[model samples]
Target: MTGTETLERPETADKVEHFDVIIVGAGISGIGSAYHLQEQCPDKSFLVLEKFDSFGGTWHMHKYPGVRSDSDLFTFGYRFKPWMSAPIATADEILKYMGEVIDDNDLAPHIRYSHKIEHAAWSSKDKKWTVDVVRLDTGEKRRFTTNFLWMCQGYYNQEQGYTPEWDGMDKYKGQIVHPQTWPEDLDYKGKKVVLIGSGATAATVVPAMADDTEHLTMVQRSPTYFFPGQNANELADLLRAVEVDPMIIHDIVRRVALFQQQEINRRSVEEPEIVKQELLEGVRAFVGPDFDMDKHLTPKYRPWQQRLAFVPDGDLFKCITDGKVSIETDTIECFTETGLKLSSGKEIEADIIITATGFNLSVLGNIPFEVDGKPVNWPETVTYRGMMFTGVPNLLWVFGYFRASWTLRVDLLGDYVCRLLKHMDEMGVKQVTPTIPDSLSDMKVGNWIQEEDFNPNYLVRSMHVMPKAGNHPDWQHTQDYWREKDEIPALDLDTEALVYS
Candidate 1:
């Protein structure tokens, strides 16, 4: 191990293993990080440790009904890899694609599955990190050391999805389920299904369940915006029809999708009313003018303040329009023996309650971290180029954009990390940190991410525990991908505030 032999990270008698870099979480980010590390620093030996039993983080974990990509596959797929499938692809398809990436790149064996990380401590004297881990199968404790650490654990609590308590939850006789913890043999067929959230999960599940179940009711406290996207990409279709090369088609489609996303965000900011009106018009046309657009469609916040859920061919709206599905936009007073009792004095009968209430936000996978025997305060650490944190040496975390496809930011961070590693090698640096000097310490810093940027309840609830941002370049989180593209790549590593040892 790189650390001193006297200091043992694992309490057990296991000897410590060491590597040049240690990547946490074998999900999308971890896979991408491996790819970049291989390409950028081929000589470096690295290891990937996953807490879960398999790869494909979100796709492997989430099996809720109709779970699919909210963003276009082109944008969601890795930048180097062309998403050749439908614009909006199902979870299985996405998982298969991830499998292809891992297999084609020969990254599978590098991943140690069912290996849960328990603790991390950095040694300043040795410039190495000692990580404690445990294998789920055997209760034996293990230890590993690395010069660099990369956290790919996504920004939400992995253990469970967020579900609020109802007044009479225990009184409910029907089966209660959360999207995150979906059972293998869940039988909603021929049953009345009532979903209790209006986020992406509920929007996705309603139409799928409606097709099979006797009825599906989406009960929401308020409405969220939904936009229509074609199931297939026109360019991909046209290119295939003309017998064009798939590689070229992939590049062109990826570029076009990014441009379109930028344009939509721009228009939302420049003309909020117009975007809102047109979005509502889409719902109106699909559900007919008679549908209660005011109650079931309109949102209190402006467009793009929260991500607009994607529904291909307006399937959800069609379900609502055809009266195959219904919506209740009110608070649930309590759960009854048969269904939910609303505060509006209305009772909705259902056999099953699916709480698609979204995830509880988490930062760095809630892993306990210490540096030189000191507990690192994450909130006080300003974001370094929206990836690394202040006072943390040789560590990087990947958090994607809320307004766009997560892979967009992931791809950027992957490439940036490779570049950073190269720079560090050239400088012969063992450790690097964005340390605040006396002059810049007094400068005001902002929250890591602004609440207004995304008005989602999950984010609002857990943001306080996360890191903060600043108005300055090194500390701010520019959610805009296009702007970040210019700033991140060009960031100078050699700065007075940045310490290299």
Candidate 2:
């Protein structure tokens, strides 16, 4: 059988479908990538394979109460699409927006739902990828071949969230749940709940379940930074009042928000004290001066070290002030029959415990990848701007920025990948891989990301499995959108580092 031809067997439910490009996942990154490919590389045949039954990856997976976007929709939404709602949006609203994108672009025809990729094998001789897949809805097996593989499946494992085992966890009779897999039938009304986490998920769930629960207490080992403000955008409102184009309003508001974020990030590095004080003072304003900011709200690290979760209109603080939610900054000692005992000897009684700790990091959707019969070892390979990796040909992974809205990099990488594909066509090459030059072979290498730069628990826990970064800019994923915005567009695709065959 020819490499590009579709093969069918009457005896078995197996077939090999070929495409110019095959994108993994149907989430925000994958959908945005698909739109760019269609618009820029009009002649290239492509397909998007989503393991889930529908679109909206994280939004669809997370169903807990008060689930919402931590980043403002103006910046979080795609640049081509206008998010004409409040700055903060619910999962349903985000899904509706994504649905509109699919409908407007006619992308549904190109997407294959419920197709979970099993193994992806690269053929050096054939200069293509042969993918093994299983239909989740059926027991049918399928095969697909593509000239290029675009991994947009996301960075975390969706099957299970990270819930640390504590002493006597099994002895506790109360129900335990993770926000990633929130059960629809979960009734929290009149229940004494203790949520364990200090991240965005905990902040979201506390206010959402506060009123209904007998009492909700947020137990965090350490405090996290938060930015609380009104959900509405004044600039967008002003533009709407004057009847400006919705598209123009979106662009203007997004740019302004980005600019503001850049300023704060800069201060976090250059003048951390000022930024720290500003953040603390903001919290004091919300919780009132009488509240103990240092004991309950202040974080050990500087601002922007971890994500400063956005709390719309200070709702979390409102919950605290209204006596519906309480914050306990201490470590969990052990679980009791009725509740949890803290390291400080304080016991919290609860009927339900929600672990919003975090998620387990995954590499390439935890798919076993083989290159020319040998398994791909990600840690041994070096990343090319955190997209392409060494020894991996005709493949790219979309790993977005931690500090900025994840969609921003999705849009940026979308353009870069399309251009690279076109350049390959021009060069008469079917394979391309990032190669570490001989001169830099002995240079000091480090973890996937620098701890000092950005160290959330998910990335910290999975650093061992991640690809290494080098001292050079070409071999590094800086995670700086401001610098990368200019650097990526100006990148030389024909450099020697990118070996073409």
Task: Please identify model 1 stretches exceeding 4 Å from their true place.
Answer: 1-10, 437-439
| lDDT (C-alpha) at residue 7 in model 1 | 36
Q: 125-216 in candidate 2: lDDT tens per residue?
A: 99999988888899688889999999999999999999999999999999999999999999999999999998999889999999999999
Name every residue pair that clashes in candidate 2. none
Q: Model 2 — which ten-residue stretch has the worst lDDT?
A: 1-10
Model-by-model lDDT, in order? 0.85, 0.91
Scored by lDDT, the top model is: 2
Candidate with top TM-score is 2
lDDT score for residue 24 of model 1: 93
- Return model 1's CA RMSD, one decimal: 3.1
Steric overlap count per candidate: 3, 0
